[model samples]
Each structure stands twice: as structure tokens, then as C-alpha cells.
Target: MSALALLDYASVFVFALTGALVASRAQLDIVGFVFIACITAVGGGTVRDVILDRPVFWVANPNFIIVASVAAFVVFFTAHLLESRYRTILWIDALALAVAVPAGVAAAVAMESVWPIILIMGVATGCFGGLMRDVVCNEVPLVLKQGELYVTCAFAGAGAAVVLLTLGQPLPLALIGCAAVTLALRVGSMAFGWRLPVYKSRPPRV
Candidate 1:
């Protein structure tokens, strides 16, 4: 399989796990688990492909859907074995974000997209799936979490890829740079409390 296909599979499986975990938290049934998992697996890629006017990934290959459903089914039966589903899902979600960003970068670059569009596609691929998952599950989207570095990390990673390409770096190195930056920033945000400043409300003057 191609690297892009591998990347998509990794993104789908991990994101599906996180989605099913959220479904478990929501106390939903098997159908719900599969629903959320499939959505989370393909949501961002679907949007990216649609915007780029390319064939949607899952539509072209239904194996992606099968993989996502399998993940959800497995998680449904075994999620309780994990000590802390919340923590598990958070880290898995981070991994999914990292993997998905590079996949997006590769697609946009292959299509000869400009640097800005590349960046947007990267962020969209990394974020939109989880955003949809959270919204459907009635949880706050991680990308919109207060002062969180989620979306920022994706953009920075995509920017890194653009920079590497502009510097004449090879495509492989550029993708590695994208994944490394995205994972590093996301891990730092979660492990080291890194954050952007949030607007604080001020009292009205008398």
C-alpha cells in the first residue's frame, strides 16, 4: 500500500477508537458506536476531498469504513478494560490529529495547491473529524477548547511542511516534519500545559 493509504488507515482507526470511546461515555449502544466511529474516521477527509474536487477517500475505498466499524465494534466490547477511557481517547485523538495532518498535506501538495491551501487542508483534515465527532456527541470540540493548542498545532505543522518544501527538502522529509511538529505541539499542550492566551472578561465601567 502507498504511504498515503497507510496514513489514512492509521488516521481512521485511531480516530474511530476515540469516537467510540466518546460514545461509550455517552452511554450509547452498538449502533451509536459505529455511527460516531465512522463519522470521526472519514469526516475531515470527506470535507477535504470535496473542497479539493477529488474523489472522497472512503467513497473510493469502502475498506476505510469497514476498518472504522471494526474499531468501534471492538471498542464497544472492550473499552471498559482501559483504566481511564478519557485519557486513552485524548492521547489517541492526538495521534490521529498528527497522522491526519500529513495525509492532508500530501494530498494538497500532490494536487499542486498553493502553500495557503495546503495549510488549510492540513488543518481541516486534522481537525474537522474530531470537531464533528464532538459536536455529534455533545462534547466541546477540542479545536475550540479554550486556549487549547489543537488547531494551532495543525497549522504550525502544515506551515512546517510548506517551509521544508520551499527549502527544496524532499517530500518524505516534509511529511515527517509535518507529523513531528504537529505531534510535538499537541503533546506539549497536553503534557506541559502549553496554551495560547484566552480573552478574559473585564468588568463594565461605572
Candidate 2:
């Protein structure tokens, strides 16, 4: 398989895993698990494809759906075994974000889109899936988590790739840089209590 295809598969599987975990938290049935998983797996890429005016990935090829369904089925049988499903979901989503950002970057690069478009596509591809899953599950969207480094990581990663590509670096190297920066920032935030400052309401401005 091509590198881009591999990235998409990786993103699909991991994102589906996170989605199924969320469904488990929501106490959804097996069918619900599959439904949520498929949506989460393809949501971001679907948005990206729609905006780009390309054939949707899962529509053109059903294997991605198959992969998501299998993941949901596995989670359905084993989710209760997880001591902390939320924590697992976060880490897996981090991996999904890392993979998906590069997949988006690769897609935009393939289309020869401008740098800003490439960056936005990367963030959208990494974020929209988890956002959909959380919204559907009635959980707070991680992308909107206060002080979290989610979308920031994606943007920084995509920005890094764009910079390198502008400097004439090869695509593989740029992708690697993107993944590295994204994963590193996300891991740092999750593992080390690193967070951006949030707004504190001011009461006396009036």
C-alpha cells in the first residue's frame, strides 16, 4: 500500500478504537458501537474530502468501514476489561491525531494546495472525527477542551511540514516531522500536565 493509504488506515483504526471506547462509556449496544466507530473513523476525512471536492475515502473503498466495524466489535466484547476507558481513549486519540494530521497533510500536498490550506486541512482531519464522536456520545469534545493542546498540536505539526516543504525538504521527511511534532506536543500535554493558559473572567472591567 502507498504511504498515504497506510496513514489513512492507521488513523481509521485508532480513531475507531477511541470511538468504540466512547460508546462503551455511553453504555451503547454493539450496533451503537459500530455506528459510532464508523462515524468517528471517517468523520474528519469525510469533511476534508467534501471541502476538497474529492471522492470520499470510505465511499470509494469499503475496507475502511470494515476496519472500523471490526474494531467496534472487538471493543464491544472487551471494553469492560479496561480499567480506565477514558484514559485509553485519550492516548489512542492522540495517536489517531498524529496519524491523521499527516494523512491530511499528504492529501493536501498531493493536491498541491497552498500552505495555509494544507495546515487547515491537517487540523480539520485530526480534529473533526473526535469532535463528532464526543458530541454524539454527549461527552465534551476534546478539541474544545480548555487549555488542551489538541488542535494546537495538529496546527503546529502541519505548520512544521509546510515549513520544511517550503524549504525543499522531501515529502517523507516533512510527514515525519509533522507526526513527530504533533505526537510530542500531545504526549507532553497528557503526560506532564502541560497546558495552555485559559481565560480568567474579569469582574471589574465595567
Candidate 3:
């Protein structure tokens, strides 16, 4: 398979794992776990394709569905055994976000989109799956929450990709830069518990 195809498959696997983990936490059945996993794996790409007016990539290539299904099954069966190791799962999730952000940016750039549009598409392709997954799992979406540098990291990576592309960098180098920066930011956030400050409201009068 091509590098891009491999990237997509990796993204699908990790996102499917994330969804399955969430479902397991929610005490979902096997079928529900798989359903959530499949949606999380493909949600971002589907949104990107719809917005771009392109044929959804997974619809054109059945391998994506096959891989996602297999991954969902694997995670669904194993999630309980893995629950105590949530740290590992979080690491995998971070890696997925790192890889997916640049992959999405590369896809947009491959289509020759303008920089602004590329950035927007990149963020959509990066975050939509996680957003859907969280909503389905009844959690506040990470990006929408006050804490964590989730979508900010995505935006940073996507913006970096666009800038590098505009500067005439090779695609491989640009993508690497984007992915590396994203991973660093995410890992740092996890290690440092980095979060946007919460707003405080004034006390109500008695």
C-alpha cells in the first residue's frame, strides 16, 4: 500500500481503539462498541469528503471499512482486559491525533486547496472523529472543553503544514514537521497537565 494509504489505516486503527475504549467504559455491548469504533474511525474523513465535494475515500476504497471493522472487533473483545492500562490507551490516542492531523493536512494540500482552506480542512479531518466519539460516549468533546491543548495542537500542526507547503518544502518534510510538532505538543500537555485556565464567575449577592 501507498504511504498515504498506510497512514489512513493507522489512523483508523487508533481512532477505533479510542472509541472502543470509551464504549467499554460506558459498558456498551460488543455491537455497540464496534458501531462507535467504526463511526469514530471514519467520521472525520467522511466530513472532510463531504465538505470538499469529493467522493468519500472509504466509499471508493473498501479496505478502510475492512480495517476499521477488524480493529473494532479486536478492541471490543480486548478492552476490558486493557482497562487498567488506560495510560497506554491515552498514549495511543495521542499518537493517533498527531498522525491524523498531518495526514489530513497532506490530503488537503494534495487536493491543491488554498492555505486557509487547507488549515480548516485539516482541523476538521483531525478533530471530527474525536468529537463524534465523545458525543456518542456522553462526554464533553475534548476540543470543546476548557482544559487540554487538544484542538490547539491540531491547529498548530495544520497551520505549520500550510506554511511549510507555501514555503515550497517537500511534502514528506512538511508532513513530518507537522506530525512531530503535534505529537510534541500533545505529549507535553499530558506530561505537564497543560490546560487552558478555567474562568471564574463572581459570587452571587446574598
Best by TM-score: 2
Give per-residue CA lDDT, model 2, range 17-127, as digits (tens). Answer: 999999998888899999999999999999999999989988988999999999999999998898899899999999999999999999888889999999999999999
lDDT by residue for model 1 over 1-206, one digit each (tens)?
A: 87778889999999999999999999999999999999999999999999999999999999999999999999999999999998898899999999999999988987899999999999999999999999999998888877679999999999999999999999889989999999999999999989888777688644
Question: What is the lDDT for 190 in model 3?
Answer: 85
Could you estimate the TM-score for every candidate?
A: 0.95, 0.96, 0.90
**Which residue ranges in model 2 land beyond 4 Å of their true spot?**
204-206
Q: Is candidate 1 or candidate 2 better by TM-score?
A: 2
- Runs off by more than 4 Å, candidate 3: 83-89, 195-206
Better of 1 and 3 by lDDT: 1
List the pairs of residues colliding in candidate 1: none
Candidate 3 at residue 61, lDDT? 94
Positional deviation of residue 152's Cα in model 1 after best superposition, in angstroms: 0.6
Q: Summarize candidate 3's per-residue lDDT along 1-206 as a digit string, tens digits.
A: 75566677888888888888877778888788878888888898889888888788799897887787787788777765764745765787788888788768867876788888889877888899988998988877766756678888889888888788889998888888888888888888888987666666688744
- Residue 49 of model 3, lDDT score: 81
Q: By summed lDDT, which 10 consecutive residues of candidate 1 come out lowest?
A: 197-206
